[model samples]
Target chain A: MSLKKEGPDPKDWSGYTVGLNFGMSAIVGMLFGLWADSAFGTKPWGVLIGLFMGMVAGFRVMWQATMSNTEELGEKNQTENEAKKTDKTDV
Target chain B: MSLDPLHQFEIHKVYDLSLMGYDISLTNQSIWMLGTSLVLCLLMMVGSLKTAKVPSRMQGFVEVTIDFIQSMVKDTAGKEGLKLLPFVATVFLFIAALNLVGMIPGSFTSTSSLYINGALALTVFVLVWIIGLFKHGFKFFGMFCPAGTPILMMPLIVPLEIISFFARPATLTVRLAANMVAGHVLLKIFAFFCIAMGAFFAVPFIPLLAITALEIFVALLQAYIFTILTCVYLNDALHLH
Candidate 1:
């Protein structure tokens, strides 16, 4: 059925990945922190710092994805507007 | 009869072997992986051997799959990224094949295993690091620091960037494995309900069918996501931005 047809655009589909990336990055950060705590015997500090860093990383990833999407959309819109202007002039 | 949804994921050794001190056993996971690879290679060979101007159905399918991945790589990483077309295509097809094969009854989903996914993700991760370093040399570290940043923010920003950079492989591994595990577990639970409902099996059966369809979609989507992310990471390595 639809599987045989062309799939959705990768640009659009890429947006769906942001949430998974954000959550997983945070979990990974916390895991790393937990490992650090065990290695350094720093108890709660490692977890706390790790969680914070992970959250920051997650936010950073989210922000980067947003920025890229916006940039692509903006370029598309600009080209479309330019084409529209040229079409009117030709007419 | 048991309602344990995770029972499907349990690995069992088929042929036990040891290499040096490490246990190199062939399990259901290994078997399914090998089967998927073999089937994929056969399909490709068959598809390519009979290429025509109009193309047969098999050739068309192969062409479409390759075109999809090619465009994805071009879009994410630009023309230079086409250099990685072979690696990117293999990753996509292999992952998608594994996922689709796992949909069959009693088949093992190799991707559901963190160890397998971890290896794949780590390969991509390490490759990105090596490529970035090789291409850009010491300047590769500049990626951690954005183009413009106040000196005051370096301490805070650099560590965060490093954390996120290191988190890529973990994120990649967890995302695919978790999606497969979650989807399969849900499917198993629903199938159990269908059987347990006895005469009213139709009730759960309907939802089970719907979820199975969704799982198929997710299987392909996760593979696409994984490949696209690999392209993105490759882009970053190549361009350092």
Candidate 2:
């Protein structure tokens, strides 16, 4: 119920983390590309997929990293506490 | 003075070593890392040497730092993480100090360099991976597949999870390096603009000064983010949900 009262705040760091992710993802993508190229006998195709995957991965982290914070930690703790209470009563 | 933002990325070969049919050049970056690590060692040694009922300024600073890191680890990684405090604190302070020190005139940010950030990120990545594996073995890989994931989604979800797992180091490296680079470059660019635009009005100095303070905040904030993320990763590894 309280979840609706509070949603994710606008973090100033939002886009920037994504930038970092893309950079690293590109490198990973390149490595993946090389493997794929060798395996598939396709020169740039694998690398292209790597690049795409890296971008997707980078954006994913950007989203996930934002979800991680003190507030979320608190929420998790609260949930755990509630679960424990239910277990104790049921037992 | 003319400004080239990417000038920071230029690497000059410090020394070339040839062994086993390979050429490796020790760089300005390698030196900076060595220097930062030494400074951190001396800092802790001196900080801990004179433990007193009433702390000296240096001792007090180190105590505050340790206490801060301790609380952070406890809060995030729980008591089990307390034993790893020294290593975590060392990494936090070393990276934070080095990142700040880079802001000084004529100093290069080791963190701004991809290789340096990569090394640090990879080290943390490897540590968490090893610890997670040691603690949970092959079961640690189960971390990717969440509890309620649909059975039909396993094929698509598994690969996504694997890719996500591999992406950690990349994210880590990029976060630190990019923040370092972006902040410094923005600071430099603004200062240059301030100097150039001064003939029209003194307003440029305001943003210049403001950006300087913001840079300091960014320096510390990025460091905290980097360290805290490290702790979170450690937590996930330890808990292995």
Please give the CA lDDT of all the candidate structures: 0.88, 0.76
User: Which pairs of residues collide in model 2?
Assistant: A33-A46, A33-A47
Question: List-wise, what DockQ does each model earn?
Answer: 0.36, 0.17
Q: Give a tens-digit lDDT track for model 1, residues B159-233.
A: 788888888888789889999999999999888887788999999999999999999999998998899889988
Give Cα distance to truth, residue B128, candidate 2, Å: 1.7
Q: How far in Å is the alpha carbon of B200 misplaced in model 1?
A: 1.8
Per TM-score, the best of the predicted structures is 1
Worst 10 residues of 2 chain B by lDDT: B155-164
Worst 10 residues of 2 chain A by lDDT: A1-10
Give TM-scores for every candidate, taking all chains together and pairing residue i with residue i: 0.87, 0.78
For model 2, residues B57-150, the per-residue Cα lDDT tens digits are: 8888788877887777777787898878987887789888888888787777888877777887788899898999999999998887878999
